[model samples]
Target: MGNHTEVTEFILVSFNGQPQMQIVFLLLFLLMYTITLVGNAGMILITSCDSQLNTPMYYFLKNLSFLDICYSSVITPKAMVSFATGDMAISYNGCATQMFFFSLFGTTEAFFLAVMAYDRFIAVCSPLLYHTIMSKKRCMCLVCISYFFGCVNCCTQTGFTFSLAFCGPTHVNHFFCDVPAVMKASCSDTFVNEMVLLVVCGLIIVTTAIIVLVSYIYIVTTILHIPSGKGRHKAFSTCTSHLMAVSLFFGTVFFMYAQPGAMSSPNQGKVVSIFYTVVIPMLNPIIYSLRNKEVKEALIRQLKRKGFETIMDNCSTASEFILVGFRDLPELQVTFFITFLVLYITTVMGNGGMIAVISADSQLHTPMYYFLKNLSFLDLCYSSAIAPKALVNFFEEKNIISYEGCVAQLMLFTIFVTTEGFLLAVMAYDRFMAICYPLLYPTKMSKKSCNRLVATSYACGCINGVIQTSVSFHLRFCNLSKINHFFCDVPAVMNAATTYTYLNEAVMFSLCNVIIAITTVVIFTSYTYILSTILKIQSAEGRRKAFSTCASHITAVTIFYGTVFFIYAQPAAMSSPAQSKIVSVFYTLVIPMLNPLIYSLRNKDVKAALKRTLGKKRLFSMNR
Candidate 1:
């Protein structure tokens, strides 16, 4: 077992060695492959042909759908061939090639999901900058970057796998040329390759996970400030699908790759691979796309329009169909103005009231309270950045936001939002200390310590904001000012830049690595300590209370970290637009909605406060 028996050509043990099973396997895989093609192709078609889907988010989705097609094709066809013909023999080169591309695309999808999460963070947490931050050019760059990285990863693994001598027995235990199976075939010492895979795969999983976790920390913290239940619900709805996707995708992938072959059986590996390679791909379209109201509506509208044109015998061009046009609606003026007034009131009332409450309540004068105050301030800034422009769009009908306005909005919004993430994570640690190690909570998170934590969060956020904004804005914008989304996103803005962005990307990637790494360590360490302390609690009642408080936070953290880590950590070539859009919904809409529910449902104090507030509001309104 030390050196694999000279594996010249590997015989894949197809789904089953039985003839009937082979036929069934062929039918099943063919059906799956067909579905994969149809689903991915349909997503691309719907996204591309529909004018409603021209936005950066949809643009990302289109790339993801295309990737899905490519990813599935890499394995499904080979599987189908084996099932159909009973030829389990893959050439040495064929096996290596298959393994390389399989790893590349699979890894690429992981990053793509992470990018989508960041997109969501910007969209939900910094709505004003969504357009600027996630511009067309930036989106294109991200997609290209994702693919490039995937290629690089493929080259490394493929080159290494091929480099090894495979003169041993040709039978590959699994269906395809998986890393472990390929290694098993190698006659030479494959210990190096195995170690390399272990290190690389572990880093990829861990790094991407950190990014997603950090992003969600901010996402959840920001969402907690919302006063309205409906608003919270809306946010949660957007994020839950993403959370599910992250859990499914990462759980399976990490289980497959993170565990060394020695520890996990080949059967276990096969089961795990099936999740990422087949089941996850099939689930992604449904999990991310179908769950999205905008995507669904767009699909339905596209279908209806196609049907209507066929029935009428008159082909109306796709350009003529308006999904979100503000034209020819005079009543929109009144509606716009009212919408603006309401948002303005909400921004002032919700954010300002939260600030006032935290400030006035002496009982809340702790490290955690300070973080909450910062959160309130962030919410105010975040809301202010977007709501005004939105109000204007509703009334003006044209919805034309200027270049300078977009840039300014994006920069400030990033500052606040990034700051919010660090702040919330800091708060989580503070809470963890309070709940886990109650005796040391005051000393550990003292006033001075609290100030330091707040300042550190601001420092991290500001630095990230400044670097991103400076580099992002430094790029000369092309005349393609028609931003698809309402806000400026990082990718969108970069994509629109007229100048070369290689240097900017280098800087961006570097910064992402550093900040994401730091936050990951901090959050992971904090959670570890918290978990340790929670387990040590002598009383079950104490443990339950502690876990309840931490559970909601952990859930929020899991969603955020999972998304961000997956997206930015990958090499640029693998960043697909379709994947980005899917992940984006989680951080943006889903997290905001989840935070309120998590907090209210978990903490009786918060629920009581809310009920009291609502009761008072009702009495006052009735009296009036």
Candidate 2:
């Protein structure tokens, strides 16, 4: 056992790309993995739980489904994490274990497909002897035989691959620890490893494939020989699902491993490998259930029972919700992921930068900048409450949020947004004092008074958020699970209610209208007096200066209210779900990113403060 392996770990260059594209791939792979889990698990559950599916075919089918789950699970979760974080390092033993298990499951799936084909052949070719010939004892033996061969093939291949000498480089140039990729990384002679790969992998693949082909051929002949057209169709239909699954699994396996160097390129190998490893598992359950009539009926019955239980409890009080996010525009999911990811990053950085800038600079320690800092903090919280989960949900087909999660998100979003609105009104008043009563502006907008105003905004916001969240959750959601919009908006959450939502709707409108009504009155009154005072200024320069200070606040308030009003002011049913989502996106994602930009770019004081801070840093460095 002269194992002189110098490399302790290998980098699994999985899904390498730009950061945005990596997120897109993460979402893509994550969705496939989730489907693989649910679909295969459902197949196993249905086959095990249902009494009608007691035959040899279904016995092998569930085993194959379990193997599919294993096959996908072996590599997908690690690959997805790598896709998200760009950390692809796998330790030496970890790589060996991954290779062993993946190979075991993959080889087992091959044998299981062939075994299923044999079962199909027995039913179609020797119809009367189907049960007695493929009995419970024999079926168990056949499944055991598949596992035995899989273990043997995988052990020999993995042993040979890991027994190689010192590796030249630790990079495996592939997503997972496949034999060829690992062998190529070795500095030692890989002739034996290649031989083992070729001989062992070839034997298992060719053997199983031959069994499937021969079984299908005999079954086809038997079906063709049937006198009646209906008999022929019935026999052929039984094998269709198995044939499809076998073809998908074997076709990808052959393209990747059978014809050595047939990969043509690394990228080609990866794409082909994905079909078998990631995509095929997700497809198998679909192929089996949809094509087989018995399985479909069993699934329906199972669902009806489960649905009855779920709806009974959930209609009274929802346990969870399925967020239907941009499902209509499925093609643009990649674009949306990339776009929203960029927007979220920008929002966090922009708002975060404003907070840091205001906190760091003494020149920015005024009543106006103090309120600006609070606004930045509010926007940051608002964006965070919705965007991270929304961005991740873009990857999910069924974006599920727990009932408690929905309540928490709704409350947090409400608090931040409500507080921001009230704060905008406060800022307008500060602007009014600056322009109209310049001498007493300092006293009127004093630190103590500014703190009180901001505190009052938060107090009002918290009360609104709590009342809204509590009422929304209390309403019975009935059987509804698919929420039309992303995140738990009050309107969307309210629409999901099964019972009379009149009280919820009234409380909702009452709180929103009151918040809007007071904030709007304050904003309008302050701006009206500010405008009057500005117009009374004698010089053109004086008018411009007065308007300059108010412009950014005006922009922020307008953008915030326009979308907020569009979403919350109208009845939930009156608002189109799509229109509401788009408007919500503006206020939740785009506005937070834009607000910091608006205030920082438009206000000269902020610019001067930033310059002074940077100059101090330069002076300090020069002194050092």
Candidate 3:
């Protein structure tokens, strides 16, 4: 291959063969880029403005958000333009600049996440010494060191990548000048470049990953000894969001670059890049805000100080909405109605019974049952929000919902669902404390703390509901008002919009996934520690009992999240309206009913409480 010194500029062949998809790409990228800016900017603003968030954890979070903004801007704006205009050309110097900054920020973010893991470990594993260990001076030193290392790493890789003679085609088969894509364009023997790339990038990734892994190993071990279940839960919750962010960020980067050869096709590489660059930046703020109660509370306080009415005024919209429940299936209408009616009745009986049992029984009045009571209440609300309307719509020729009605349903449904997610996570934490930190359960899960946790769950749910409902209805529906699903869901309603739904979809996708991912992380993390503790127990019976205690909640979580991910996380093109409705029924109706049964049947305390209540009723009847 001959070196072409005259080629002053390289063309970025981004989505070149598919001209039809360019507009879609342009709109999507533009929306994502805008959100990336707003979310990261908001994170930084809130952290700076709030005094409560002045801890080491948030200090790193602030920097991470800033890094996300910078790295995302490197590729997103240019990619959006490339999609909008046909001008995909980039000067040699321009490409090098982009490559340098991209590497700089990307490497910095990776190191930052690892540093965050260390911060969390210190906080969870050594709370008394955390302030001393991660002092302001040390934190600043760490941040500066991260950037210094990032600069050195970026310069080393960028210099080598660009130094290669680009004698071959100047058309880079990527949205931006990524290290691999640019290297592929070099005409020289690039074995040394690939080796340098593999060795250097591999070391950075592995070293950071090892730091995180080691930190969590200690963190989990420390959490397991917390005498109170609440204490263990609180310690674990602090790191859940960070773990989620790390998994997403490092997982994608590892897949993209951690290979001896080109890992995948260019198209696949571009898709992976899109996630880490465009999607992850927009997600960091949401992940942190949703998982961190302090951040959420800070946001609420800030909003209240600015006047709640202003926020409400901006969010208020949607006069009426017609729910296209189950489409036109008159033949199965009666069957569907009967099926839903039975399911609804069963849900009420099950969840209602659980609530009644927990409230009446003195023996069941623990932190665990306190959360269970909230869970039951949320299940009742969640079911009522969807099931009644669904059953009514099954018989009606036209499934119509007033605008206010739709908004109300959406709000109630979102609140309960979101609250339930957090409630389940809280329950998992409670179990972890009970099993792992049995000695501290009473003090850690006091009445005051339990009440606070329940209150926070509901508050977080309301906040999530308001944001999701507002965003969904804010879109101009035009004439397309008929929702495909049986109830008003964010995705279904967003899909009904006649205008470009990319932004709406992006927001909805990011929000739902963040919530789901955070909750999942908390649950899994709690269990990871719980399982470790269980294995160490000397008695098999004790281990069995501990496992049994978590069985009901785990089952309930699996059924609920499995259905949710199937409905929301899946690509819209692959799922039909009918498929969505069927899955929705399982979660909305069937799971609520099953939850009480799973708890009651498997739980010794619940069964004992039920027997006592039945015995008293029989004795009263005999006296009568």
Clash number for every model? 76, 1, 5
Which runs in model 1 stand beyond 4 Å of their true positions? 1-8, 16-20, 261-264, 307-624
lDDT value for candidate 3? 0.82
Give lDDT tens digits, candidate 2, residues 9-82.
Answer: 88987656333235335535665676588678878998998888977888998999999999788999888778
RMSD of each: 21.8, 19.2, 21.2
Tell me which residue pairs clash in candidate 2: 315-478
For residues 158-252, could you state the per-residue lDDT of candidate 1 as single tens digits?
Answer: 87777777665566668888887777766678889888888888888887788788878878877787789888788768677777878998898
- Best-to-worst order by TM-score is 3, 2, 1
lDDT for each residue of candidate 3 in 218-242, tens digit (9 for 90 to 100): 9999999999999988889888899
Evaluated at residue 509, the lDDT of candidate 2 is 75
| Shift of residue 464 alpha carbon in model 2, Å | 36
**Clash pairs for candidate 3:** 227-440, 228-440, 229-433, 319-403, 320-403
